[model samples]
Target: MPLDTEFSVTVMGLGYIGLPTAAVIARTGAMVTGVDVTPAVVETINSGRVHIEEVDLDGLVSGVVARGNLKASLTVAAADVFVIAVPTPFTDAHQPDITFVLDAARAVARVLKTGDTVILESTSPVGTTEKVRDLIAELRPDLTMPGRNRPGEQADIAIAYCPERVLPGRILVELIDNDRVIGGITPRCARKALAFYRRFVRGACVTTTARAAEMTKLTENAFRDVNIAFANELSLVADTLGVDVWEVIRLANRHPRVNILSPGPGVGGHCIAVDPWFLVAADPANTPLIRTAREVNDGKTDHVIARATAMVEAQPPGQPVACLGLAFKANIDDFRESPALKVAQALAERFGPRIHIVEPYATTLPPAIAATGAVLTDIDTALETCAAMVVLVDHDIFRSVPLDERRGKTVLDTRGLWPDQA
Candidate 1:
């Protein structure tokens, strides 16, 4: 199919994934309208400024908005393609919540017309695309949807699921270069979405059933979570045995068949930390390993907090401690489910006004951390003033600190970033 440069796209939710996706699509000469519930986000994008951080996204969004190819809005608009890129956060009990997906579907239903293609790019549980189809069918009975029509009959609109499989810091590059799994309620739906993606994607768009696509995303994250859990569990064992976990991994990895991922304070971020729970929640009895992996990763955070607390307590009274990095991962501003943030907050609450934070990405500490009287200071000031240092996230700047600068400080290196002590 020939690419449609004149296509109009409305992408719901202008957060991390959605905004970058909208900007990328607009670069392909498509008229893209990014929709968000927050008025501030919409206004920010319309002014050619982005609220979220991503590589090259600001320049791309600026060029697209300046060229009049992309705009942001507070409500849905009629378009040939509607992409639902909202969040699918879990409930308090860790059950996969599809309320945001369904709500976005309802909003799209208002402006959905014949021949429009609706794609759910949000990471969702199995049958979520079908739920979206059902909700749209309920709202607009006048039009036919995929799965509701006969085998030989075509629906008035197409619906498909294509989850974003990009890393945080590399979203713009991966969005265009990574292979995509395009699944639909029907084969035609898959083909339609594949064609849309081919307009911009340099990757192979493989097609499959909607459920498989959903499960594929979950499986990808769960696999990483499991491997990470192994490394984290090994870290605990190494600690108990009085050995360096990083040194052990380094020597073991010399064998071609053995490769171990670096352990952190814990698994964080919206995907790996949260997606695996959906699978376990779907079938609790058959997923003991998955459940255990989640437990081990979560437990690692508590262990880090306890260790940091012990180090802080060992210091004399009035000796301030510095917590480095708050983002879940390094070099990004996203702090969702970040273990570093949790550890920092815990330390601040336990030792009021004695906790200083060194997060280069954030200008000010979040309310929760600020309320604990923890001051956000520069790395230089933190290293000079604080008596103890806890390296939570291995950000590049923190990793490059000279060994001499770390002298005389009680360092709790959760990420194994610093050199081995003499």
Candidate 2:
């Protein structure tokens, strides 16, 4: 390996994944230029402000800017390394939408120089890196690529697939801490990519072919989806039997080898809920567990919605119901694929103008949430005004709220993080 004084790194897309990775690279003493199509995000980063809601991101961005190792741009500039962390959302038919990744590849291709390494960090279909390499080669035919037999006949660019396995709120810690899997189109590709991550990655870089790397990421999440679906399915069965699923899980997991995941309203996130579908969509016959898990999770939102509606129906018609928390999970302000949001929306729609929502972490809601006729209010106001309480997320604020304080209200705890004392 070669020791260089400065590595010019360009990160495409300044969303949750890109921003944190760019900031971390800069923190490791690399010159990182972050590129985003959004002018507001670009401006915010340049001013040392963070638009995302991750913990410690603002400070990280501030530190990176203060050291002059990080900057934001709307266009890509020449760099020794380029990290493509763009979005890979699905289409209406639930197929892999690689438009953003392709655009990012093309963007980097324009400024790509000899000896530059491009790492595709997005969760994608198999052969995605090869597709990116082909896209780059198409744009810059002047560049020579490494032939299978002759490693010496290498191209101006090298490509690898290194998918991120970080949670949204824990991106900063996980980026360096989690064991990474690096898959290169060639053996040389894998080594170069591993070298880049070694600067900050405390975890080991497991090498493999690019297809395996891509499928490994997909399989990791699919495994989670399958396990959670099992728990969810068991929860439904336990619900029918009038048995506490959490208690059942506790007893079952007491055995020497059982490791059961806790059941929630549903699985929700940019990754777990979405990525499994990519595999099932690709090879439906081979991925029955993945398909079933997705079905179980997707079906959970409706189950929660029904439960909330039933709880509301049991109350008087004019009763004001308080919905505690709006984010997908606990303590954070992410609403993407949140079953809590669906339950709240269902209740608000069913109750119509009678839903008093108290999401202490989030003051204003997006348009979709605002359309549900929910009155966003302070926790105290929501508790004081509403007759029924529905605890969605186990946020610290909701945990801090005493059950004794909620005397007259009917509390339906979805997370079961709190006790319901009548």
Candidate 3:
């Protein structure tokens, strides 16, 4: 059943996940306030403009803001429900850093009141949700916390962990349609969060303990990382043996039980590359396979950098070398932890003005690449001029380039988009 009550919602950290979540929840007839530390993000959304790129997001946010169902703020506002969707990036040592999550928790603690539901939607380490619960309990001792409350007693607040499961290109549809695993500090807390999600989610909402839900999100990403590692490792073997990794995988998958993932420059983005390490950090000794998978995936990026550099090196000293695509995945503008970005940055540092980057989605090169004198060019400009090219991302713009246009060019296709040219 849908939630019967009309409740106010406060969505903290309006980035990739939070802003869309805020907009979608606003569609449910709930008053949604999207909060962010950035003044520009607040201003942009308040003016019915989105700073990020996601399909159908700008229109949705615009409509919700115009209809008075949604607004963005620089400060937290009191609401019936609070959603924390901040980035939980790793530290310099690759350890999971929950400082942003903790800061968001403190902010929520200040505004929390009796009966308000606090749900964390960030992908985090196991027990990080418990840490949030503990921090909030300490800050607001006047209110009773679940899991710390006496037996047979009701707590003053509900805290839950529900991770988002959505692809970047299709976040809105998946956000509404995907099943959710709502985990709480207690059974009552889980039920409380489940009721809130039922308001918007078309898919089933299953209840569980907070720790289990946290692990489930990590496990999901880690499992994919492991599969990708196998493909990446196979690609390396094929490269060494002068064989087409794509054709090899295609043939191997003819067997009933074989299903191999495609290889890329390396794993990137906020989830698959980052979440597995959290599990490894929790118990390093027993997580050799997970740890090794991470190593192999990271190594693939270095491999791409080295091989792409060699390709450019083979060309004349002053010849332009085009590096295609920068986004982590195809058809999206997001470049968080992108291997393509890493490759471009390294090549730019080495070749300077000789490197030309062609990312159809990016209007301007990232500052780091731009500072290195790597010019951002269109596909036509890259193909007409550059002597050597490396396909880092399989964006449609790069895929549609015909063979005749690429005839004389030296090409290294990491994404296997042009298996013939590769």
Per-residue error at 340 for model 2, in Å?
1.5
Q: Please give the lDDT score for candidate 3.
A: 0.94
| Cand. 2 TM to true fold | 0.95
Go through the candidates in order and give each one's C-alpha lDDT: 0.93, 0.85, 0.94
Which model scores highest in lDDT? Answer: 3
On residues 1-422, what C-alpha lDDT tens digit does candidate 3 reach at each position?
Answer: 33322679999999999999999999887899998999999999999999999999999999989988899998899999999999999987889999999999999899999999999999999999899999999999999999999988889999999999999989999999999999999999999999989888999999999999999999999999999999999999999999999999999999999999999999999999999999999999999999999999999999999999899999987999999999999999999999999999999999999999999888999998899998999999999999789999999888998998898889989999897782
- Kindly give the stretch of ten consecutive residues in candidate 2 with the minimal lDDT sum: 146-155
Compose the digit string of candidate 1's lDDT tens values, residues 219-337: 99999999999999999999999999999999999999999999999999999999999999899999999999999999999999999999999999988999999999989999999
Clashing pairs in 3: none
Quote the positional error of residue 306 for candidate 2 in Å. Answer: 0.8
Residue 163 local lDDT, model 3: 100
Candidate 2, 1-422: lDDT as tens digits: 34343788999989988999999989878889999999999999999998888989999999989889999999998899999999898877778889999999999999877888999999998888999998888888877653333545765567899999998778899998999999988878888999899988999899988999999999999899899899888888988898888789989999999999988888887788789888987898988878888999889778878878888888887878888888888877788778888788877777767888888678786566688676888888887777888888888887887877787778777676764455
Error of 3 at 200 (Å): 0.6
Candidate 1 Cα deviation (angstroms), residue 100: 0.8
- RMSD after CA superposition, every candidate: 1.2, 2.0, 1.3
